[model samples]
Target: MRKAAALGVAALALAAQCAAAAVPVQGYAIKATYPHDPQAFTQGLFFKDGFLWESTGQYGASSVRKVELATGKVLQKRALPEKVFGEGIAPHGDSIVGITWMNQAGFVMDQGSLSIKGTFNYMGEGWGLTSDGERLYMSDGTPEIRVLDPKSFGEQRRIKVTVDGQPLAKINELEWVEGQIYANVWQSDRIARIDPFSGRVLGWIDLSGLAATAKAGKDIDNVLNGIAYDAKTRRLFVTGKRWPKLFEIELRPAKK
Candidate 1:
């Protein structure tokens, strides 16, 4: 009886160690707030050449716009066809690429003019897109992140995101930050920092209090979504679908 009890305790200890090995979720400290278009249902956000490029969804309302970060003014805009629901936007070589949800179609546009230059098709639902200067990374509303050939827009490889060896699905918006892939899990206020090569989730950023600060009585789809980073300024920004403000945040190690 004593031997069995000892073995049980040992097993419990082992299990505790395994649980402790799970990656931790970090929290963010808001650094600054910037004006954002409250009507825009932001699906993808990025900073480029002193402008904030955004993709807004909703079939009849979808658009790709370059906005002034301070004034929230649409500097340049391009509307998607009424039937297409825009999902994500990414900057490629000298052009920009925008994807549509469920339509399985994407558009390539001139970065300078935001004019449609060409179109490309893929097989699944488009969710998020980002690039690391050479290759394109995309999410299809699944745990898988597809690496695409920038030239042909063909899938070159895939990385299945996992946290503590368990697959994490609904990986939404994506931003390649400092060699790690930062992703928004749909409907969650947490962002996962993942290893691009290993698909291991290194940590998570919790932005729980952000949406609550929105203007009272403003009815909006407030799920935490957009993520953008400025490598030169080392700034990180996050916002939500129809959120009135964009926040610059700094991540801090979460307390155990």
Candidate 2:
């Protein structure tokens, strides 16, 4: 995730997108809340085997962590280089793959030990990342998301995300859930559920109530961001930068 939200991609942009698409926004009810590190400037997040894997940004504070979902315990972590800003991470095979901000350099790590194994390269500013067990998906703070080869990191294709033919820019913190791409519209309390094939936003998940901090004039940069899904149990979790709690939520119809 970039340190600051990009220009022309704020709450108003999201509102405009919603208006243009006439898309349905789903509300959510919190099923459970768990502890999260207040210091983690979460950029990437995912769930696997009862654990949450997170990547946090900030030049000096960047690190990749494996945390306990129940208590938010940092069971393992690997601090990134002091000058490199971590962006997003996805588990690829037996190794974990991650990208950095502005450098175009990505690294692979031993999944179990959290030690560096190798590195790869890509083009563009990395923002969010995820996988569909066969290929990888990456967002670059733009309206388009890139599909890359898992091993070579080569761009295979690009998906131009749109709502009523208007580009949904600044796509960040991605998760692949149920064969669809779930993305956080940067600095907005809206998550777009996109069809990977058509690039059309099927609907929006309104997190405005959960993102009350920004509305209350608290941390503006700490708006809604991260998303993770536990497919086995069909649990969806969402959180934000510096948030003290992570919530497991179930989507429900918006009230009239």
Candidate 3:
């Protein structure tokens, strides 16, 4: 009887995997294109109030900046210290919170001035970060996302990201868009649209061939890595590290 029950459970799990695998992969329509700094190794991005706030990576080259959307011009910038490699950033009330790659220490910047107001510490590596206006969602290069208190940046809970009942690794550069979490799968050209609560990958935005137009330099690691959405106008944008162009794209129906 015990052996029979174990086989039953395994069959049920396989059925779940098949169902999840049937989730559709989506395509996109390029609504518009704008210039981006090819030198900016984009790590995180958010759109607000007609401007783009971006966080860039690389040791001794990390920075947070406010850029004009139309011209790709950096209007305001603040460079991080040489010792820390920055990862992700999100806005919290009147400030912007930023996380580093491995230092486990993140900083809070005043939104109006881009000045470091304070610092906070966490337990593990920080890769990508986003905000839903209430809580902060942080990814640590694993399949799990840590839900954090926006005020204290304290870990409240975790959500394990999975596709077809399997873990999805190298999740990077997250953005909370229209109640769903859109994440870039590191080193891949596609983005995963995930359910924040269930941690289930609802679908994937297959962005194949989009990167070829960005005119990225010879750095082979400059895969797609940034996403930003404007809540006011509902415009979705995507780009890559050291990419020369940023695209405003509209989602089409999912493909088989």
Ten consecutive residues with minimal summed lDDT in candidate 2? Answer: 211-220
lDDT of 1: 0.89
Among all candidates shown, the one with the greatest TM-score? 3
Estimate the Cα RMSD of every predicted model relative to the unseen true structure: 2.7, 7.9, 3.8
The local distance difference test score of each candidate is 0.89, 0.89, 0.93
Which one wins on lDDT?
Answer: 3
- Writing each residue's lDDT as its tens digit, candidate 2 over 1-256 gives 4534654467669877667648777888889988888888999999987899999999999999999999999999999999899988998888889999898999999989999999998888999999999999999999999999998889999999998777889999999999999999888889999999889998889887885632323777777878999999999999998888899999998544
Clashing pairs in 1: none
In candidate 2, which residue pairs clash? none
Weakest 10 consecutive residues of candidate 1 by summed lDDT: 213-222
Model 2 has an lDDT value of: 0.89
Q: What is the per-residue lDDT of model 1 for residues 114-217, given as tens digits with 9 covering 90 to 100?
A: 88999999998999999999899999988899999888999999998988778899999999899999999998878999999999999888788788874412
